[model samples]
Each structure stands twice: as structure tokens, then as C-alpha cells.
Target: MSSTAQTADTTVTIVDGRVVTPDGVIDGRVEIGGDRITAVGDSDAETDTVIDANGQLVLPGLVDIHGDDIESHLYPRSGARMDTEMALAAADRANVAAGITTKFHAISFELDESADRSPELAATLTDAITDATDLLVDHRLHARCEVTQKRCVEAVIDVIDNDNTDLVSVMSHVPGKGQFRDIEAFRQYYENANDRTAAEAEEMIDERGSMSMATLRERVDRVVDRAHEAGVVTASHDDENPREVEQLADSGVDIAEYPITLETAQRATEIGMTTAMGAPNLVRGESQWGNLSTAAGIDAGVIDTLVADYHPPSLLAGVFVDTEEPLHERVKRATANPADAVGLSDRGRIKAGKRADLIVVDPDPTPTVTAAVVAGQPVYHADTTIEVSR
Candidate 1:
């Protein structure tokens, strides 16, 4: 992402919550000076504002590496479009309400002019998200490049050059590879997403399968190299095997976004790349698509981050699930790990001198965000009656 501009005279103190840290959760308070946390301990120092957290869970702001639910925001229904500015703002509110303070909006480039995802639409979405900064959260762009869509390479270059893209991941949804190994699943996805008949979907799948892997690899390498040159992070989407994982890591991929199998995730981690799994899979207790279970990967200690995937609530909910690690470690996977993978080291942890992006959640059996402080500003509070003394 980008650096948050430091401010002045915006000091705040949060007290009476279980403050989470790398060491563990502590019954303490935190101090914020301007946009950075000045202390994270038993400090009761006075400030411009004091937030009584009501003995809630004070955690680091969640950092989601990849989430495309905004696609529904931009295109909420079939063949319908909403105002981009309004949609972005609304998406931000939904994410923050779910305790996500940072998001990498996954936008794809499907250059067949399908109207759902195209070069033009991706560019429009980038501009819209960038312009809607009034929203109370940090927004970054993740350019998902479909190398098979060769026509969109120039547009991808355009976005990397002009748009505020934080990460770029290679994706190939061919029926026999990547996320569409099951031809039936692939057919259903194409038919539903593109309104194609079964025969037409099969025909398109066949066409995509017949494409030259060498050509796609060359184009993907170009995009990856270009992004790397720009100091932007790179990830590979839904790799199916260790060999593919090795190749992607060799291609300068810094993270593995949803490797499809246990072996792939393990190998990615072994090769020093952060492995991410969908939070929805962990929340649902299984992978509905018959891929690797997120909880299994976590149990094996192969996964390092959990993304919202499509649902914002899953990020917050996945933390409370029974993991072998403590609450702080679970929060780290959703916060510090993903942020570090995307080169955002400033706002992920609840440490002194870190940016003050934090959330107060009632850590009951069913958790909910009570308040969110972005850059030391209380932008969202669930119960306005609970006053924040100034």
C-alpha cells in the first residue's frame, strides 16, 4: 500500500481492553500520538481523546490481501451497474464494520470484453477506488492479471504505471488448471458468470485449454518483472502443485495466494513465500470446492495469512476458531502477515511507532467491531451512546 501521512495534534488513548501484541494479549492500554502508537502497555497517559473500550478486545486492524466482494459492489446484480463512487464508499463501510482496516481490492482483467471484467472496467474500478478516499479505511489495488488474455497486457502496464496498485498476481482460470481443475465446476462458473449455455461454456473452456502455456508464461513473466521493478509485491493465484509453486517463486512471486493443495502451500512456505488461504473456507469448516481445507493448512503450520476472499466477516470470525496458537498469533495471520507480504510494514502491528490502525471488538462467542480508529481518528463507533471523552 501507501504510507499514511503523519498528522499532528491527533493524540488519543484507548483503555480497559485486552490489548493484543506479538507476545500475547495483555490487559493494558495504548497511547497514540498523531497517527502512530507511542506506547502499548499499562500507560494511563492523558491525551486529546480517551476511548473507554469497555473491556472489549483491542486488536490490530485486519489486513486483507485479496478480496473481490467489491465486484458485487460495482456490479451488484446481473447486467446492472451502480455508481462507482457510491459503491466503493459502501464497500469500505461494510469492510470496516467487519473490522477490516486495510484491504487489497482484487480486480481482474478479462479482456474478452465480457462486460463483467475487462481492461476498461478494471481501469475504471482502479480510478473509482482511488477517488473514493473519503471512505474510512485504507484501500489498495491488487491487479489480477489473466495471462491468457493477451490483449490486456498493455492495460495491465497502464495500471501499474498510473494506478495505485500494491500487488499483482498471475491468474489462469482454464478449465483444467488453476482454480478450475474440475471441468464441471469450470463450466458452471462460466455459464453463471457469463450467461453462457452449457455448450458455449464447454467451447470456451476448450479454447482456453488449447492456449499455449509457453505464451501465457512469457506474458506473465513480463507483467511480474514489470511489477517487481516498480517495487510492488507479486503473488500467484491457485497454484496446484509444488513444481508450479517453485516456478512462481522463481518468477519473483513474493506470496502464494491460495495454492490449491497441501503440498503446494507447504512448498510455498518452505520456499519462504507467505501462503494465504481463504477465510471463508475456515469459517465454513471445509473447502466446498474440494480443495485444501484452510483449517488443515493452519493446523499443519503451512499457511501464514488468511484473506477475506469474498466475505469481510470471515476475517474477524476466523480468528476465534480453535487454533493451536494463541489469540495474538491468530490475529497476526490476519494482520501482520498479510501486511508484511504486501510490503505494508507500517500499520499491521500494535507496536510503538506503528501507525494507529486499530479495531475494538467485543470478543464474545460471536464477535463484533465496537469501534475503529484509523490514523488516531475515531471514524466508526457502533454505539454512539458510549462516549469517547475529549
Candidate 2:
């Protein structure tokens, strides 16, 4: 079955789509040749294939800098490990269906039960990610470094030195700060994982808290240096205040992943940092942890990128958010801005000589994805019929 609506040179053309470019959303057509966008304009040029977007939004494919939805594919219902290849293949299908062409599986080198991103699973997943052949979109590894675990520095350095990590972000998950501020909140995370009882979780949290990453700054420096030496972009995670943001800048961190408060986010942006937020947080209208809203971050010009984070589909959903920002700017936050944040300049925007990564969005009331193209090839076409409104 063809994923495309119509078939024509060896080229593909999408016409009558409200294409979102950096300038603005314009009624235009885009032509693709090989793996790149050949042209985007008012050209009426004939091509081998033509896809009529039917006046729906034609946008650059969502570039997700951090997402771990793939974790579910690994441990479907909790218990033994499945074939890693099978898991990644299934995850990539879901990724393209969500209109995300550039996906960074934020595999953590941390210890956690709820997420399979634990120490034991890191190598297995990293190997699967590196060698997966059935992926429909561009896949990269966003190595989440648990800085407090001094034992894992050599392992992380080895991967970065081998060029396996495309991006690295230093994380400190101590109990008293960032995500686990409240001791009860920390205890609940462990209790819900069902690995430890509340009392056991509390004990573990206290142990980890005493040895926070603040005390391991030297190890953080070493890991950051190794990542930078390998040309992997480094980011700081869960910034809490202006001082932390400033310190991250002084340490040469390329991006600030998620700031806990509005003041922190604003400070990060002020220091010439790329402030990113979760697309899920934006689409859901709030953060799960009751932190600063990504919408508010956007309004204040603090959010430079919106990553898929834990949810893949939220990237596209965030586009239809009712914001005062122009559609083009909002779209860029998910697409071009993230691509650039990760030092990728080849495949974000719709222009001649750029990668043909795009999503045709059905802009009807529901605003679902209709089709997705990656590297000039259609990868996903929605099976549901798009409903028309009166």
C-alpha cells in the first residue's frame, strides 16, 4: 500500500499546503529530490508525485531532542527483557507516526526501576540504538549522565569517546533539589516503582542526597570534558536558580534542558543559553511536578525549544496550542530550534538543500497528523479518514 496520496520524475511535490517556514506560514508547494528539499515556493512545477495537503499545515518534521517513550517498547508490562531490536523498531514507527523525524532516545545511565534506563540496561539499549537497521527516522543517542554516580564516568567516557553519544546532559537526582524536592515525593517514586518500600526508599534517598552532584563537581567536569572532546553537545538538566544557570554557562554547557522555575528559565535564557521545555508539559497545559509551565516560558521568551521529553505525540499536539506567538515561531520551537540546539543545521526548515523531513498536519478541529516524510520518503500515512467540518 502506498503511503502517499498520489504518485508522479523520481521526485515528490506537495502542493497547496500552508507550509510553515521561518518567515511565516504561506500557501506554497515543496519539491523533494533524493534526501533533500529541492525547492519551496509558489512554483507550479510538475513533479513525479504530488501530495495535496488540502490547505492543511505542512510543517518541518518535529525534532525531538529528548524522549524516552521507547522505554515502554522495551518493557511492555514489566518483567523480563524483550529483543532490543524489536523494541527500537516498534518505537521508531510510533515516532514517525507522531511526525517526529529526528528522535534522540534519552537513554539514561542512571539507576531507576520505573525506567529501564538503569546501569544494566544502558549498554543493551545503546547497542540496540546504534545498530538498529529498521528505523524509519533519524535516530540519535542523548546520553543522560547521572553525575552523582562516580562509578559510571569511565563507561560514559568510553561511549562518548567512541562517538556513540550525540548529546550528553549532566543530571543530579539528589533528593532535596530539582525533581525530588520533597522527601515524600522522592519516597513515592521508589514506592511506586515497587522495587523498595517507603522506608527503604527513604533510606536510599538519604544516602544519595548526602552525596549530591554538587560534591561531585570534579567528576562532572571530567565527563563534560570528555563529551565535548568527542564533539557531543552537552546540556545541563533541571536548573534550579540563576546561580546554577550561571555556573552551567561558565562550564560551557550548550543548552539548559529544563528549568524548575520561571526565574531560573529566564536567567538561563539571559545568559545566552538555549532553554528547552517538554512538549508534553506544553500540551498538557502544566508540568506533572507542578513546576513552571512551558506555556509561560514561551510567553516570556524563555523557551527556545520544546522536546518530546517522555511523550512522543505531544510534539505535534503542542503546535495547535492557542498562543499569541505566530504559528511559524511556535512551529520552529519544536522543529528548527531543537535541531539547531543539538548542532544540527541540515534538516530543520523547509528550504532548498535541506533534508526533506516534513509532516502534513490535518488542521481540522482535531488537528491530527496525516502523513510524515523523512529524507524525501514518506514513512507514515494516517489510516483514519480526516473528517471535514461544515
TM-score of each: 0.96, 0.93
- For each candidate, the alpha-carbon lDDT, in order, equals 0.86, 0.81
**TM-score, structure 1 vs. true:** 0.96
lDDT of 1 by residue, 62-179 (tens): 9998999898888887569898887787888899999998989998877654437788888898887766646788888998988877767777877888746989988888888868
Go through the candidates in order and give the C-alpha RMSD of each one to the true structure.
Answer: 1.8, 3.9
Candidate No. with top TM-score? 1
Residues forming the 10-long window of minimal summed lDDT in candidate 1: 1-10
The stretch of ten residues in a row with the least summed lDDT in candidate 2 is 1-10
Question: Model 2, residue 212: what's the lDDT?
Answer: 44
What's the lDDT of the predicted structure labeled candidate 2?
A: 0.81
Best-fitting candidate, measured by lDDT? 1
Runs in model 1 deviating more than 4 A are 1-7, 112-115, 384-386
| Candidate 2 colliding pairs, count | 3
Model 2 segments more than 4 A misplaced: 1-9, 113-115, 212-214, 383-390
